[model samples]
Target: MEGHACPHEDILETMRKLLVAAALAGCALSPLTAYADAPGQSPAEKADPAAREISADQIEATVQFLADDLLQGRDTGSEYYDIAAAYVASRYRAMGLTPGVDGKWMQDITFRKASPAESTLAIVQDGKAKELELKTDFITGASFTDQLIDMSAPMVFVGQGIHSPENGIDDYAGLDVKGKVVVVVSGAPKGVPGDVAATLSRGKTKVASDMGAVGMISIRSKSAMESLPFEKLVGYIEGHAEKWVAPDGTVVVDAPNLKFSTYLSPEAAADLVDSSGHDLSALLDAYESEEEDAVRPTGFVIPGEVKVKAVSEWEEVTSANVVAVLPGSDPQLADQYVVMSAHLDHVGNHLWEAGEDEDGEPKDTIYNGALDNAAGVATMLEVARVIAENPTAPRRPILFVALTGEEKGLLGSEYMAKYWVREDGEPVGVVNFDMPVLLYDMDDVVGFGAENSTMGETLAAAGAATGIGVTPDFLPDENLFVRSDHYSFVKEGVPALFLMSGVENGGKEAFTNFLKTDYHGPGDDLSQPLNWESARKFALLNYEIVKLTANADARPMWYEGNYFGDKFDPEGPRAPAPAEAAE
Candidate 1:
């Protein structure tokens, strides 16, 4: 048996081998050899009764329907998404599953989509306004909010707009940005931890907003532009920008207080800062150059104010987190909920611009999100159906949530975790299903963040029950833990498990190709080679884990003083088992 706490790297290597070996031993029809008949395999290994009961046919039906072109990729704030929601809700009713909230399976979420209407901004210097090109010199802004604003505010250069009192760093010190526009370089200086820097940089706008700054313009540091090209950033901002709304009906985002926010192209950023007593190139070198710790505040405000005119319209859009509940058998522990979750939304489709392919045919328009999520949603619906049909209920209620706006920014899960109540009680744990990419009929399952909580033990039990070995995340550098819907539950101090198919047995090549070629693109459709049986087996594995969690003698809890538990809820930690605690 594994301990409650496992070191990430050691356990990752150990489990990788265990997972690949067991998978090769015939965890299913496909192993390392890709659907070959391996020797010394049990009948259960070839075809699981539970998996067979779940039925690949049913899984295919749901995936096909959800990933179809008619749904238009299930974009967050679109009419097509409404139709998809209706379909999921209809399935819940047909299965006789109880609603998770208010006799309605749908939980309303508010969102904001900001688009540039008539965008024009310039630098005011020496009684002459130097106008900037929209996409060339700069790009019109989206994000934070949608509104028309005309402001003549002074530009103050703050290193990265960071003010960390915990660390002895304050770029705002000896600088006043009240009612002014602050120009900041994108990203943080060296020596700051990546996650911490990201947290600070993300919250920088709030600091600026609180400082009474009316607006901000971000210059792409060379490192930033190198990481993500200017053209890609432009594509992001040009689209319909969305963020989740709070109870107050306002967009609940990082930079709510600012009247405007914009990102400047590197060339234009240099042009704007020229001859302003501060050199952009020199400032960038101070931070990113060989002198790692030499970066600090440069108390130089540009000589003149900036003239910005942003024209945009605003509209209130709504989406939902589909919720259904299955009650537990035990009266004492049933109130503690085990959430079976997945995101129902995808990037949807980019608008059909008039264009032609090399063959002189119309280009691909719809983004059919087959593996990106519809698979997970279909898996969720199947689990709900099987549980509802079964007579024996688990000890804890299962909250089946198909979230919206995950592609937009995990907005649906964020709202659900903070607001949704399971029979007026909190969640005991979360099992998130996402991007299964079950293209290879393979061996091994991967669990992200399972080591941080009791979910690790539950995952071991699940693998044992399903005859599939579990491994730690193979790609820890990708930050998979924070990239999905499970993160919201983690932020709330709830223990979580994010199940993924491992990349072994040629699965790595398949996964890489899928991510590079099909992920978020129109090609992620039914036309792609999908392993329906493997998807069914994945549902079985998830079902086993979630069931173990639901029927556990004690609810799942974060390991003692872990990063998330220590940071988000210092008071909450799962009590160790008597035997384990005595070790």
Candidate 2:
């Protein structure tokens, strides 16, 4: 029989002792090894019916095709991505899944893309203007509602510019930033909850706009400088910014009240606060200090009028999200859906600055996102195939979605999460697969958002049945709970869970190496040593989760007083934690 433990000599000896002990005591043994292939059925497949239909070879084939160089990285709204979407749709049809969107297998989304053409930023003080060089002091600026920006306004510094009553934080407690440019440091304070801090970091722009600020200039904090250096940040922002267009032909700008927004280097940020009676270095020291009592910078006015002008090149592009459904057998529970999703897009090739190989031939700039998302889509597809082929349909209908524009801030999922619901059926929960990093024989899995809803219990049950350990998020600083396609569903008040390979059984080293070496780079191709066994295990785990959720008597609900639950679904049904519920 295949064993559950890795095949190291030391582990094998340990497992042998455990098995002997269990047999002597007449205790029933757990399933045999993870790779058991006993007589046309593995032990895992026997325990999990859905696992029988999932083929690791099929997952590999799907990833090989989607992450090929010919696909040009599957950028959203591009022809290459359209081909990928069509491929997913074709797979759904072949699996005998009905269309999810009113007989249509796709949801079309239009987006307005804006790329920076040129910009000029200057600080006018003492009747003299000091112009900042682009790409040196300031990166770029964009305004979704305007093609050109020309304004000069007084500048105000509001520290981090956060305003969360729940967190007892109000950076703008007494500041009036009306008609002024708000200068603030990026990210939240260290003591805030990781998930809540992530939300506050993104809410700065909206806070500034709501306070009648004309523009916003972000200065990277010490943490940002260490995690995402200025050069790396520039590389990320050099491309075009995209916003989905609504059905009414209007683009939804979150901070529509603001006309311009840009980021500044730390050096440039220090220069702006040179004569403002506050030492930038001292303020930053306190802001990032680890002491028990560290004072944060408060709001203050800068001694300058910041004049910034920008020109944007705008274009309209379209993309589609592939959707499919497997209806349930139970008429009552079938009215609700359990959603399984993965993004179908990646950062496209940077064609403008394409380089050359040793032979002077054009170099490979295609990002061929093998692990960033192509593998995630492949895993979701295998799960869908297994569920669709099950002899008895689940009690609740299952909706399989291949979302688009995930690399562009989860646009596709956002649209569907907000507006794709039907009067007859609603999505009760989401299980998203994104960048599972299946490069090692994983021993455990990390369940993001597991603690926020009843899905935590479902995840626990699924893990136990699959002989996989469930672990907490080891890298909470990454704020992964709010960083994937599943967050879109969470924002719309649906309970969601994102499971990824955890940092155990050599996973930490492998995952860290991947982030440093290949994440978001051309090196993320198929040349890497990816573990097919790990991929199969992950797919089987998710399949088991779906089976449990779809067949459960009651729909998943938010745990009472959870931050995300209260914030997004204030009036939705709430329950005690799973452990408490049993009591």
Top of the candidates by lDDT = 2
Model 1 C-alpha lDDT versus the unseen true structure: 0.76
Q: What is the TM-score of each candidate against the true structure?
A: 0.82, 0.90
Candidate 1 residue pairs that clash? none
lDDT of 1 by residue, 501-567 (tens): 8866767678778877888887898888899878877877887787778878888877774556665
Where is model 2 more than 4 Å wrong at Cα? 1-44, 357-362, 578-583
lDDT of 2 by residue, 352-433 (tens): 6476668976666778899989889989988887788777789999999999999989999998987774556999999999
Q: Where does candidate 2 have its weakest 10-residue lDDT segment?
A: 22-31
- lDDT (C-alpha) at residue 361 in model 1: 69
Local distance difference test, per candidate? 0.76, 0.84
Candidate 2 TM-score over all chains jointly: 0.90
